[model samples]
Target: MRFVFGKQDLADSARRAEHCFLLTNGLGGFCSQTLTGGAARNDHALLMACTRAPNVRWNIVHRVEEELTRNGAATHLSTQTFAKGSPEEGWQNLCFAQVDGLPRWVYQWQGVQVEKELAMDWEQNTVALRYQLENPGDTPCTLTVTPWLQFVPKGKNLRKTQTFTLRGNRVTAAGLDLTVRTNGQLTPCPLGWQTLYYPCDAPDGRRKTGLTAACLQVVCTVAPGSRQTLDLVFTLEKTAPPAARVLRQADRRCRLWERQGGFRATAARQLAQAGAAFIARRDSTGGKTILAGYPFFEDWGRDTMIALPGCTLSTGRYAEAKSILETFLQYEQDGLMPNLFPEGKTAPMYNTVDAALLFIRDVWLYARYTGDLDFVRRAWPVMERIVAAYRSGTRFGIHMEPDGLIAAGQGLDQVTWMDVRIGEILPTPRHGKPVEINAYWYNALRMLAELAATLELDGRDYAALADRVRESFRAAFWREEAGCLRDVISGTGQDEQIRCNQIWAVAQPFPLLDPGQEARVVATVQRELYTPVGLRTLAPGDPAFHPVYGGPQKERDLAYHQGTVWPFPLGAFYLAYLKVNGHSAAARRQVAHWLTALEPALREGCVGQLPEIYDGENPTASRGCFAQAWSVGELLRVYEALERSVTDFFDHK
Candidate 1:
């Protein structure tokens, strides 16, 4: 799916800056910049290297300042928009921009064309930038590329370094021993600290001022009626000179997408390829880990489990799925899965309540998809340990209640997924039995029982436990007055707020609710919480609902789950909707229509991918991470399911 744009698309600077493209090297290193030209945010860099395999990232090179000179006339193809004013306006000359496997841009002035394309090597932390200049004018054109260097770690502002060493075509810094080489002629330039402003960082209270240093300028000249190509490579170690091999890697990636059931549709293919970016190679663990999102977020256990099926299983990377599950299983603590795997550290944080239960569910899905009983046998002991840990007791006061339902959360620990705290106050305080947590618990128990039965092991105990939980769930969570299940059942009473969490009851495999109740839950959710982008975290009528999700950290935390719309839950909502409607042709058609809203979204914000969230108000605008793993993964999963239903219908007919 080539997301193509023309001059009209790149005419506006703000629009061009907002629509960005991403390219990743499997090692978690990546290259991203706006279509307009220069880096829009501090996170946008030509080479954001992962010094460690899937963690410990640093922004080595920020952006390049390009200039085209001919006959004593010069034109800048790069723009830097600071607070005072932009020093250059090169966006107007940008003729076209397209992003498929690679992001390519073309700038034309007086019949002279300069094209820039970026690609990253799959195995190493290397990025190759290819520049082609075609001179159709009477005189020759000289293009000078001065790359802005910032050897700062992720989230840290660039600082002035005392040492800037340049030798021939290679340049290295004091603290950062980076290698910058190109085939074009390189001249040593005066090194000085240049101040650059980041508009995207200002809102987040991050460092808006960036100090960049340029040590060398790469110049390539094109004769009249001739074209010249230059390859510039950046890597930690000097290996073979780039042969434009990154394009071959990009081709292989696109082919992987086509093989992984992506040839069905444009959106499916785009999502399938986008999903692959999140599964980074874990060099430290010798396995794999799912990055939660791009530009921010790390390898989170809960997010990995939640994103496993859609990212790996549905995307036809089953081995990667197994590796991820295996990696998480190795870190299981007292039957609990780690919520986060901190960078540069072996210690894991096991604070989330749902990750363990979700891990069991993910394993069941993995076995069902691959039909690999051997892997299940290897994983069965871990699953049993998880159930035992939850049944007996675990950290954060997480244990099964007397009523057969699971209850989690301590005095200060917000263990559930809606976990957001502003100092001492919990915004979405789910201290008792959360609706989705119990649903996951019931599903985990039933799936474990099924797995045991499939393996011909003792399964009656888990089956009985699932039965008891089902009975307890129906009796406690179903609120007759509201017609939907309560959000959470606490000591005081049931909180019947119109939230999207209850949809899991009907969405999961072992649904606790009956058909009529399931239909009612879907109806209530669609009526109140559903939106074109996704379901709102809270209903509009609720007093606690915050329509917008912005401002300081405190204000953002207050509105995070109170009303922000998240795309991940909509995947479950569609699943419940399809199940309730019997997965008929009408249900399939409705699902297809509902997905049309996201079709435009693929073209908008973060081209060819979905955003993590949006505001809860009408006309929902994309916010948070530009390209989210589960957001794209969930859409991919649902699209695959819809296509499967259509195929199944034809096969039966």
Candidate 2:
């Protein structure tokens, strides 16, 4: 799906800033900027290179300053926000902007038409900009492009004392080298220490200003009544590829990814293309991993497992799915997976309780989709060890109870996905047996039993354990009074607030609740937590519910899980919705209609991508990370589920 922005869409600077575009290399490096060609966030850069595979990233090139001169008249073609002055309103001259495979912008002013297209080289820290200048009038035109440089680690502020040296077309700063290649003439024009403002960071009390320097400029001329093409390329490597070749390779890869899932809907195909951005190489493990979200999050264990089925398996990238699973398995300890691998750190943090269980579920899904029994056989022992560790005990006080229900979280550790700790305060403290964790536990037990049987091994033990958990879960979690299951069950009491977590009990591969109970759980969730975009963390009537998510760190953390609406859970909700309704024509039609409601959202924040979250009260505004892996993954899963529903209904009919 190509998103085009005309003059009207670019007229509003605020809205245009919120609508950005992203282009990622396979090594977790990306180039992103607003639709109007401005850096709204500190993370926005033309060349954010990853020195390491997925973590050690540096912002080498922040933004390019472009100006077009026609018959002695100068028109600024670049937009920027400065610290103390008004913003450069170059967007006024932008006639059209589009995000197809890459970002393209067209500026038409005074009979001079200049089109700019940008792309990043695959698997390399390189960015290319191709300009096509068409001068129809009797006067010639000149296009001047200047690149602003900041050789700092990703998210770090550039210092005034930072030294930079330029020689010919090469630049050296902070012990890093950058080679500039352009068809136009290169001039060494040094403009030092310019402070740029990031309006998006101000609300969160983050560093809103950053310093960058203009070290080099490129100039090209187009004669009257003729068209001229210019190419500008930047790379950390010794050499840079041609702009046209880089663009062709990037477009070919995206087109192949878009066709991978065989999705009939345009949105689903676009999401399939977007899913490739999250799958990146892990230098530490020598394998592939899925980034949790773009612009902030790293490779998280729980998020990777949750997203693998849709991001890789659903898109028929089976090898990547297996590789990601193996990558996590390489770090598994005591039957527990690492909660996250910190950026630039070799060791992984093992703090999550659900990642290991979710690992088993993903393994089952991999087998179900690809019919790869060999992979399952190799993974069986680790899966058994995980079960054994949980059966006895693991880190953070996670253990199976006497009644066969799994329990986790202790001390200051927030084990589940709603994990947010402010100092000693644990906001949204779901320290007991979280509803989704147990749901995953039950599903893992059943999956193990099935896998054992499939592998022709003794399966009685796992089946019996699953039965025990099923009986214990129904007795412990079901809330007869509330017509739904409790969010978390503990020895202290039941945290009976309605949340999106309970939907998993019915949505997992193996349903833990009975038919009537599943229907009631689905009904209660739809009535209380459902929104057009996502499901709220907590119901509105609860006192702890936070209607909006904003402000400083503390306020955002407090509302992070209190009531923030997340899109990932809606995938499970739709699956359960279809299951409870028996995948009838009406039900499938309703789900397809609901999925269509998300089409407008694709063009809202990041074109062709879903965001990490939205506000609980007013969900129109996209919040948190602009592009999220699990959000796109889950939406892909939902589309796959809808397609399957259609096929099954017809087959039965």
Q: What lDDT does the true structure give each of the candidates?
A: 0.82, 0.89
lDDT of 1 at 128: 82
- lDDT computed for candidate 2: 0.89
Question: Judged by TM-score, which candidate is best?
Answer: 2
* Predicted candidate 1 versus true structure: per-residue lDDT over 465-514, tens digit per residue: 98999999999999877789899887644287889999988888777888
Q: Runs in model 1 with CA error above 4 Å?
A: 83-85, 492-494, 646-653
Q: Where does candidate 1 clash, by residue pair?
A: none
How many pairs in model 1 have backbone atoms within 3 A of each other, for residues 3 or more apart or on separate chains, i.e. clashes?
0
Clashes, model 2:
0
* Cα misplacement distance, residue 368 of candidate 2 (Å): 0.9
Candidate 2, residues 394-513, lDDT tens digits: the string is 999899999898889998998999899999998878877788999899888888988898999998888899899988889988999888998898654438789999999888877788
The alpha-carbon RMSD values of the candidates against the true structure, listed in the order shown, are 2.4, 2.0
The alpha-carbon lDDT assigned to residue 296 of candidate 2 equals 84
Colliding residue pairs in candidate 2: none
